[model samples]
Every structure is written in structure tokens, then in C-alpha cells.
Target: MSVNSQITRTRIMECASKEFMEYGYQSANMRRIAQAANVTTGAMYNHFSNKAVLFDALVQAPAEEMLDRFRGIHAQFKADLPKLTFVHMKETAYLGTDWMLEYIYAHFEAFRLIFCRSEGTRWVSYLEELIAVEERAYCDAFGKRGRRVEDMFLHIIAASGFQYLVECVSHDLSYEKAVAVLDSAKRFSMAGWQELFKL
Candidate 1:
């Protein structure tokens, strides 16, 4: 793309992001996005094929980046589990959450769009996917002991963590406030996990 085309695409993306975040994927208006970007609808189509494509352009980068990070964190968590202590877990959780909060902050609009306004996108079920992965990993690691806890309980906790993140971003919490909230939630979750798994 030339300099002018690049600028136009960026403008279109920014405007489309706000549109998607405000009206959700299902309700977002393509013409409004074009209008906001100061481009013709026909011109916008030259960049993005359609509304879904535009939504993908708006969110795919940040969503994929977060997925990679979440996967890495889960892998690391499992790798370190054999010798995990409550103290170590707490420390790692704090640092991990702090890092995650900062990442989310950097992509706040993208996250808000996916987490709160992606009603018609593939990302709408993202939290469920994350929870299922975590729950399966826990069960694999702990065997019959982990199975003792109901699947619903496992799902609830996993879902809660994702929801907590959405809450932090949706409310626009500051870094310190977000970290503090994460720490408090981590402590509470740690206590529950310890009681459940005897970790």
C-alpha cells in the first residue's frame, strides 16, 4: 500500500473498531464506518471484503496475541506444577496477572470489542474455549483427584478469571487498581484451589 492508502486503511480500522465496539458485530453499520473514515463504501470494500472481514481486521491481531500468551502461560503453569508451593504459585500468579493486565491495557479497545461486543464473531465463544482448555489441563495433571471437583466448578473458576479481565478492561481500571484486584482475586482463588486439590 502507498502512504495515502496506508493512512486510509488505518483510519478505516480505527473507525470500524469504535463502530464494532459500540454496536457489536451484528449491529455495526458498514456505511457509518466508511463515513467515519472519510472513505466511500466502495473504497472501504477494496480494503476489507465485508463486515466480518473488517471485524477480523479490527480484532485478530490482539486476539491472536492474547491466545499465544495464554497458551504459553498455561504450558508454564503445568511444567512448574510438580514442585509448586502456595507461595510460589502466589508469586507467579501476581506477576503473571500483572503482565496480563498490562498486555490487556495496551490492547484495551480490541479486547473490549471482542469480550463485550463480538456477539456475531467467532470470538464470542472465546472464553468458553479458554476455560475448556484450562479445565482439561487441570484434569490431566491431577488425574482422579482433579476429577473429584465437578466440571461445572472447574468451568466456573476458569470463566470467572476471563470475566474478571473483561471487567477490568470494561471499567477502564488503572494499572495499580487492576493489579490490586487481580491479586485479591488470585489469593481467593488460591485458597479455593488449595482446599480443592490439596496443593
Candidate 2:
């Protein structure tokens, strides 16, 4: 693409990110994004095929990368299960959570879209999918320990983590402050897990 074409595409994505963040996928309008970008509909289409495609362009790479990282971490955790003691488990959990937080920080907008602004998009189910993965891992490690209680714990802890992230973004918390908050939350979550499971 020519320099002008690349610039225009970037502009479209910038405006589209704002639009998606403000109105979400379902309510965001292509025309409004085009207007905001100072480009026509035809110009926008020259870069992205459609609204969903544009939205995907804004978030897909970071989202996929984050999920892939989680999958890798979970695979490692599963492999080490037999040898994991409480201290080892806590260390592993902190490492995994810290890695995830770094990814989120790197792609803050994409995650904001996925976690907070994706109500109408296919990505809306991302959180549920993550929780499902956690549920599966819990089941594998702990056996069938009352599905209702298991789900409740998983959902609450996951929601709390996500909410902390959302607050971090929405309020523009400094990196040090955000990490401090996240570390505290992680310790509290670990304590809850230990108490619940008598680990």
C-alpha cells in the first residue's frame, strides 16, 4: 500500500476504535466511524471489508495472542500438576497472572473492547470461554466438587479480576498502581481458593 493509503487505514482504525469503545459492536455505525475518520464509506471499504472485519482488525491480533498465551500457560500448569505443591502452585499462579496482565497492558484497547465493549460482537463470549477453561482445569485438579460451588467461585474470581482491569483502564491508573492492585487481588483470590479447597 502507498503511504497515503496506510495513513488512511490507520485513521479509520483509530476512529473505529473510539466508536467501538463508545457504542460497542452492535450499536457502532460504520458511517459514523467513516465520518469521524474524515473518510468516505468507499475509502473505508478500500481497507476493511465491513464493520465486523474492521472491529476484528482492531482487536484480533492482541486477543488471539493473549488467548494463545493463556493456553500455553494452562498446558504447562496441567503438565506440572502431579508435582505441584502449594508454594509451587502459588508461584505458578502469580507468574501466569502477571504474564496475562502484561499482555493486557500491551494491548489495552483490544482488551477494553473484548472485556467491556464487545457485548454485541462474537467476542462477547470470550469471558465465558475463559471461565469455562478455568472450570475444566479446576475439575481436572479437584474432581467433581459440587458444580454449583465450583462455578460460583470461578465466576466470582474471574469477574473480580476482569473488573479490576476495567477499572485500571477506565480510571487511567498508573502501571505501578495497577500492578499493586492486581497483586493484592491475586493474593486475596489465592487465599479464597485455599480456604475453599482446604489446600
Candidate 3:
């Protein structure tokens, strides 16, 4: 990539991240981000077509990459441990939630912008993808069923139980307390799936 493109992208991410954190997504401004980067609005436009595109590139891209990283690790380490083994569970938990918290800490404003400012509309489908990943892992540990699996997937997401737990641990609790929650969530999710499989 050209140096100018790289610089502009980095500058936009850094400044937009701060701005999005300070303001909700709706209030985020490309002009302000451009100004913060010491670039004119035209330069910002050359890099990103719009605020949505910039947000996706700078914020969503990193978050999605983290998820992919988690999934990759889980797939790799899964076979080394028995189903629900400590290694399996702890690594998975860390990859998914604990690390997610780290991402939030680093990009706290970006996440708040995506969820609160955008009303989480953009995250819904992505959340579904997360559920599918967990569900596949769950099914791998348990037996796959058609209707029941579907129902449980919808139930978990709809109840917002896991999401609520994530929010509670990530935001409402201390870091140590949040780690504890991650531990519990991993165990609980594993146990639940194991039971579903009659394993």
C-alpha cells in the first residue's frame, strides 16, 4: 500500500476511534476525524467513501478478525483435549470473551459506537455468526439435532443471556470478576452442550 494510504488509514482509525468513543455512532463525524488526522476531508474521502465504510474498516474489521482468531485456535486445540477439558475450555473462553474484553479496552469507543450509536443493527448478523460458531462446537461435543439445535440457538440469542453476561462482566464488574465470569461461562456452556449430547 502507498505510504499516504497507510498513514491516512491509521490516522482515521486512531482519531475516529476516539471520537466514536466520545460520541455515539450517530454523532461521529468524518470531518472531525479528518481534521484530527491533520488531513482535509477530501483526503479522508480518498481513503474511505463514508463514515460507515471507515467504521467497518477500522473497528468492525478488527473485532471480526479477533473472532476469526478465536475460532481458529479453538479448531486447532480442540482435538488435543477431551471434550470440555481445561485446556479446551480455558483457551476457548480466553479467545472468545476474555480477549474480547481486551479488544474493548483498546477500542472501547468503537464498540460503544457500533452497539449503542448504531443500535447494534450491524452486529446482529455478526452475532448470529458467533452463535453458529458456538453451536457448531456445541454440536461437535454433543449430537446435532435439527429443530432442537435451532430452537436453542434462537433461545440463547433471543434471551440475550450470554450477551448480557458478556456486558455485565466486561463493563459492570471488575476485571478479576469478569475473568471469573468468563470461567463460569465456559464451563456452563460446555456442560450444557455435553448434556444435550448425552455424553
| Runs with alpha carbons beyond 4 Å of true place in candidate 3 | 1-9, 73-124, 144-150, 153-165, 168-177, 184-199
Sorting all predicted structures by TM-score, with the top scorer first, yields 1, 2, 3
Off by over 4 Å in 1: 144-147, 195-198
Candidate 1's TM-score reads 0.89
- Ten contiguous residues minimizing lDDT sum, candidate 3: 140-149
Q: How close is candidate 3 to the true structure, as a TM-score?
A: 0.62
RMSD values for the candidates in order, in angstroms, are: 2.1, 2.6, 4.9
Candidate 2, residues 1-199: lDDT per residue as tens digits? 9999999999999999999988989899999999999999999998999888998998889888877778777888788887777788789878877887787888888888887788767888887766666665665556423334556776676666667777887676777888999899888988988887787
Candidate 3, lDDT over the whole model: 0.63
TM-scores for candidates 1 onward, in order: 0.89, 0.88, 0.62
Q: What stretches of model 2 exceed 4 Å from their correct place?
A: 144-152
- What does candidate 3's lDDT look like per residue over 1-199, in tens digits? 8997897789878898777666756788788898899999998898889877776775576667767875785586456435465445545655666666666556555555554455333653655565666556655533322224565764563345347444743364655666677677666865765566454
Q: CA lDDT of each candidate? A: 0.81, 0.80, 0.63
**Candidate order by decreasing lDDT:** 1, 2, 3
Name the candidate that leads on lDDT: 1
> How well does candidate 2 score on lDDT at residue 135?
60
Query: Which one is best on TM-score?
Result: 1
